[model samples]
Target: MREVVLVVLQLARMTVTDLLGSLNLPEEHIQYWLNRNEALHNFCSQNETCYSKYELNNKQCWGYEASCSKKDSFSARKAKCTKPNSWQKQIFKKQADFAKLAEVLSTITPICVSNYSEGSSLECSSHLRFCRAKNIFFDFHNLNAKNSKRYRNDVIQKGQAGGNCNMLFNEAALRSRADEKSYLQSWAHELEHFSSYPTFEVSKRQCDVIFEKPTVLIKLDAASSMYHHFCDFVNLYASQHVNGSVDMDIDILWWDTVSFLAAASPKPLIIHYARNCERASEPSALATVIANKNCG
Candidate 1:
């Protein structure tokens, strides 16, 4: 009965999205919220026994009072369930594919193949000059059109704005401001004395340097250099990790990125992205973004 109801709810949500047509939210964003809805239902159901036990004793139910108030309806449950960070974190983690992404990231050979290996002064200078000229060097604002004209006109126009490290390297955007590229380029060279390790543990740790900074990650474009690098790398790694290639949809990637960011960083960051990012325009999309913004 619960499964049937969940299915019906999912269909209803999809129907609303379809009715919106081009005005609908990004398919990726829509599906992301749908997944969240399912997770919310599952979470509420899983704790049903606990809620009942608490009620029987005439005690205040932990997640029920503020979140699941008026438990007779699903809409009320959803609105309330999204209020707490702890609840959001659990819902975000319920994504099995996200675990796969995380696993691949933890296991794969990282972009940092070596510790900071300084280049010659002339070489570093040239790289810096190229970056500054293209406005893709250091300032995050420069890479974003909202801040720098050179960035919007040159970097974005040249197709360098929303690519992964591999794509950036392919497009010769490697010397730009990407944290991954910066380490792989001159900055690491300055710290060349730091030892390098070829093992997965060191690679994972090096990657963590980027992942640990969700605040920075949330500021850049979702498809920006570092973001795409991490997301695409996971897909590539997962393909090799399993028997056949695992080709996850772009929507799933978006969902994973959003959920991860929501869990680790401030809600305002994600909310700002939804409100400001070029891709997010419709009301429903903004609502979903705001709704899921509180993930712990």
Candidate 2:
């Protein structure tokens, strides 16, 4: 029985239904054989050229088609596969937008904070207030600084702050009395959130940045770390929010992040702003654009 099954599977043209019907197998046995045949077919289709060539030759090739050998001419057409569909074109546009944003971010000076003597909670609150007054969206976690050690310990253990926003730094992380460069980088990280100027919601992951007038939700992934996870998050966010009519954008700062997202999530407009502590010394293109256009 095993030998017969093996021979039947080796024959590419033989269908499981026909094989089972001819064998007069029991109903239960027929189902088992059918399943095995399907598994074998799938495996061969992936790993064996005979199956792939047969399938490809039968289908109408979408992109640029190249000729194969004469013997297998029926299945010899090779698709160029380079031409992106409408969805792919949109992703490319988003990636380009991100690159432009990153260029702007790289040039802007970091937000200056002279002192942390009063603690970062107060400063954070002040920054938020300033943003609110200016019609910018900025959220601060651990607003009260209720437990500094707890926040630090939490960050250390979890590798992230206890909140959703990208600017999830604890008071300790903020108050370490780091150099001006570190402070500038941190401020840049926060300010970059407003580079695109979308309204933010209280939701942890879903619809973080919301544009009310336009009814668009922007997914924010500010942490420059974890490229793959960020891409996954962008894809998941788009799947949840983007309907046919709704607008969406995935905002990112790191060039690396933008590159990953470009390949991963092609639906959302990825706004990129590549900047960090090392690049703080340079003049920001974002600032220049704001200065010339009189907008943030």
Candidate 3:
């Protein structure tokens, strides 16, 4: 497994020394590799392309058009541009697949039609299909082109506005600050929250077809921060009840957040903390650690 991981990193043109420095591995483990100078030299010599551009290091190559440095390998430059594009498609597909699953779940379960015809309640009922189906109500707001400025001014004057379970998605804010890929990622973050409905859990086997495996794996700090917020909310709500009573219905919210972040992280570091947060007997401590680590 170590060798396979190393090979993948090498192919991506990442230095093993840099990888070791980033990780919390022991000094002895680092020494073991350093001591094997002959073996290491042979390995690197056989995979010279991993360390340098080799045959493609010349100015004629596409990657060398701007910089003729050997460090700017053809494969590395190609990978750098293509990896993000690939992940963007994967993230968008993941959101679409989850939306389909939510639609299927809504059909199987009973939906509670809202009596209120005009307002945030009605909007929430329409957008959050499964949530309303379960008789769980929440406010939904879309701060778009027409309302973004007014909403921001109101928020500044009255302080941050939100209600219990309320979801406020600012499409304009996301568009103004984030690029297309990041915007899609933000949508994926919201879709993850919607997929955590209890009705979806009842059909776990069927849902597994779409949700079991990750479609994308990348380190997204925004997505990580969102997951941390979800986790923190769960822990805070649980603490409000006497004797640490928790509503099991809401467990899916944070659990799905964990799953999404685990899949989204480039390494297993966030996954490790997320799993620990999930299993901890007490709240706040482990969850706080994860929130601090990711949100920082």
Candidate 4:
């Protein structure tokens, strides 16, 4: 039975962690399998081949190179882990991935886009007023699995993962006084989330549903229906803050796969930004043109 679940997880392109808690496996048993079973360890390690240096932590496994910490072990604990670029990226090839996302969106929703906050943040979807004021966070975090000093010890990194947005980067220290003043001002953006391996739930309208083809990298599938779920969740979340109304102006941005989803479906108004493309000297506007038709 346990072997059956493990096989299913691999087929789903998921980690043992995905099946760990639900399996009713005891802690010691699971750990021993993960640490002692060479084949099992090897399988878990292959799950992250596409992560960019900016996306990994420890980076030590034979094939994988990232560190993970759940406030404590056990699948129930709150911890952080890293994910590579979606497998879909490899299957479609970046250019084709963007085209497919754009093409799919064109058939449904509207789109909009904007440049990311120059010295963006892992803090929240938007630039925090205080963050911008203190000039503490600059750009994004990208670390090599091979290096430890690359990551800020104080700022806990929650790789963009499931739960409403593609990733909710929660700074571990925010809950404590280590960075009090800034924490208070930015608390508005703080929200707890729920997640599985490739999916995260935020609200009815918002879903960080990472997509996977039988043999492809994960990609955002922002078809109109799925995005409708995201917006619906956002709207529901807004009701509590907006005095009984969800503002249409509040927008959601896509980080990594935003471009990919944008290209998959074109009819929908789904705007997105691609900073690396511009900086990568890779023809910056390639994605902008695809998402522009629907962007506000």
lDDT per residue, candidate 2, 1-296, as tens digits? 11100000000112222231233333333222322234433543564543443342232221111221222322122312255345644444334222223223223222222122211111221122111011122232212233222112111111111122223233443333221212112222333222221122223232233222211112233345686355445433222211111112222222121223443223444222221111111000111111111111
Ranking by TM-score: 1, 4, 2, 3
Whole-model lDDT for model 2 versus the true structure? 0.24
**Residue 8's lDDT in candidate 1:** 4
TM-score for candidate 2, please give it. Answer: 0.17
Model 1 / residue 228 / CA error / Å: 17
Which candidate number would show the highest TM-score if scored against the true structure? Answer: 1
TM-score of each: 0.19, 0.17, 0.17, 0.18
Candidate scoring better on TM-score of 2 and 4: 4
Q: Please list the residue runs of candidate 4 whose C-alpha ends up more than 4 Å from where it truly belongs after superposition.
A: 1-252, 256-273, 277-296
lDDT tens string, model 4, 71-119? 2222212122243334643333223221222222222211111122211
TM-score, candidate 4, is 0.18
Query: Highest lDDT among the candidates is held by which one?
Result: 2
| Candidate 2 vs candidate 3, lDDT winner | 2
Q: At residue 186, what lDDT does model 2 achieve?
A: 25
Model 1 lDDT tens row, 1-296: 11100000000011121222222233333322322333322333355542342222221221212232233322223443435546654554334223322322232222222122211011111222111001011111213334432112122122212211211122122333122223122222211111212221212221211111111111122344676545433332322222111112101112111214322212333322121122211111100110011111
Candidate 3 or 4, higher TM-score? 4
Each candidate: what lDDT?
0.22, 0.24, 0.23, 0.23
